[model samples]
Target: MNAPRGTGPYVDAHHHVWDLSARDQDWLAGAALAPLRRNFTLADLAPEARAAGVGATVLVQTVTVADETPEFLALAADSDLVAGVVGRTDLTRPDVADTLARLRELPGGRRLVGIRHQVQGERDPEWLLRPDVRRGLAAVADAGLAHDLVVLPHQLPSCARAAADHPGLTFVLDHLGKPPIASGVLEPWASAVRALAARPNTVCKLSGMVTEADHAQWTVDDLRPYADTVLHAFGPERLMFGSDWPVSLLAAPYGAVLDAAELLTRSLGADAHAEVFAGTARRVYGLPGG
Candidate 1:
């Protein structure tokens, strides 16, 4: 299928670049994650992104380290392909507001459009509701930045609660809350996603599905149900397309990922297609010309 097109360059709302030499990505230690241990730089990603017709991309945080955000901001500052960054900071810190201020003051800091944490690894399902975390979330709202939720399905209830508690903050759900596509189960995850979508402040990214499914044999049909669920729940306006690249390479090439997203949303009309492929991301991230 042809890649999805819109009135403007498609905004890839989620993707990442990491240099293993600068710092080890401890998560890449497993044998299953071996393919990603090497360096993935913007230079490597830019040509492919360009070929995919992606004009602007949002660089998302991969690790929980505070230093990573500044480094990502610096990278965004220098790159034309990267128009925004969803970075990481210690949200539990008492001085999170000040930390956010300091981050914003850094080079390319204006490109810091959002914040994210490894909420998927947390033991406590209610981690988002913890007093310290909630305080930090409020600080994020005060700074006029969004929070990216990279959580597992079971933890989604807390996500809904957090969104309810912080109506001013936009919660961008990454990877459709990491649904169980490999097993073909969607009930609880779909229901939970709908509940979260009930909050007007929440948004969902149509990303990471290729990796979530049976990597070697998955098809666009396998991803359609989940995509349809979010499309119905959030509608095109609150939904966005994300390549989830490098990580997405585990299951399919960058172009194949884009192709699958295009196929899944092919049923929509021209305007809805534009919203899913470009418009939603631009507005949600507050990117240029949004």
Candidate 2:
């Protein structure tokens, strides 16, 4: 049998890069997000990732535009840093499977590991359970791609149900379902998370806490309870680290995000740390190299 995989290199399982000159990020129109209105490229992230010891990254989708996935795939094809991409496609369309197939035929198509929709923007909390959405999820599973869930706490039950319905598809919960860190409330979110974790096919990203918290006044202790809850619920094997990058810049710098993640998991043993920082992402995303 093969030996256990040691902590080879950290994998940033989630993050985003965008160019404003090419297209408008409608989400950035608000003044609160004005700081991120400027373009952020892989070039901007490379040094910060390297300094943080992150060797590979999964560049995630920002907008729901059809062209964005191909752009991300091409970016991954060109960059040594971006190992995989979780891109966007309209899940309600009848041609989604074909679209996924077409995307795989693009420049960096092979680097496409998963699909994501801005579920948080949906008015319906049970959007994932919609028949058309469920059909799209089946297509994603058939394509051997995971689905990234970027939903809020109340929507997590739908996430759990989606995971249950599509056992073949891996449901990666981004930002631990975006917990209420700022308010310091854990109840329904924690309970919903535990329920989702019980589904076995689900995974959670240990990222985005800083922004979820009161950006300026947040402390590690403030995040500890939530972190501990996921650690207990999903365990390190099902949890991966992410920087959330320039978006995370709203609250803290890249190094600080990585530092916080390191501190949060410091109590874990080396093997568990290996899983959270690297192995889980590698296995979950089918990323190449360490």
Candidate 3:
């Protein structure tokens, strides 16, 4: 379907899709993300996405299980709007290189643009700097795939260090390192996000900030600092917009997230807006016909 004329070319670079009947989402079983316990398919997201001027999207993984990776690949194979996928893999596995190779052979594995681990859930702050993890990251780089860092503020430095260590791999930080937005604290997170952005290969995703803020009353102002800081750090060339979708539903609707992003960058020139809206995502994920 063609996007309406005179509007932006938008691509929600971060979103998720899941079917509970097909497989369990162990992470959403808890209270924090309990609202997303049910299935969220493309049909449920497309209308909101289209209303927001999104022409395509990158489907991210919700579960850490290896089995789910292939499932997502299959889903992408059957969905045209799913431009790319950031799938999960046990990076610590000694056979991680083999795993990546095998995954590339799967149906939509060719669309496997990046790899992500639920590192934010790990107790170790230095989990990313672990020797095994570093080796696995090298395998991802060697396989010519981007590595998406799903981490917290505390892990930003280690994440930065990892990016520095592996210059060959493209590092995309998830959710601006998930800043402490609810309390309005910006010191360490801002500093860390900038430091990470200093690495040429590292880019940041403008996603998940709403959930980090007070869910009930969060507004565009609440999301500005995080977005502004990242924009300054990575600049429009390396930054991209993402909905976080059902996860974002905890704080606001999908269209609201796009509106917040649109409002935040209103001052940016049209060229810059075009890049942030869709160009950066196309460059990062290697979107079709880009």
| Top candidate (TM-score) | 1
- Candidate-wise lDDT, in order: 0.93, 0.91, 0.88
- Those runs of model 2 whose alpha carbons end farther than 4 Å from true positions after fitting are 1-8
- Residues 22-98 of candidate 2 have per-residue lDDT tens digits of 98999987888989999999999999888777899999999978889999999999999999999989999999999
Best by lDDT: 1
Task: Name the candidate, 1 or 3, with the larger TM-score value.
Answer: 1
Clashing pairs in 1: none
Order of quality (lDDT): 1, 2, 3
**What tens digits encode model 3's per-residue C-alpha lDDT throughout 1-290?**
12122256588899998898988877776687789889899999988888877898999987878888898888889987888999999999899999999999999889898899999999999898898999999999998888988898989999889989999999999888899999999988999889999999999888888899999998778888889999999998899989999899999888777777888777788788888889888898888756
Q: Each model's RMSD to truth, in Å?
A: 1.0, 3.9, 2.7
Instruction: Judge candidate 2 at residue 248 and give its lDDT.
Output: 97
TM-score of 2: 0.96
Q: How do the predictions measure up, each by TM-score? A: 0.98, 0.96, 0.95
Backbone clash count for every predicted candidate, in the order shown: 0, 0, 0
Ranking by TM-score: 1, 2, 3
Poorly placed runs, candidate 3 (over 4 Å): 1-6, 30-32
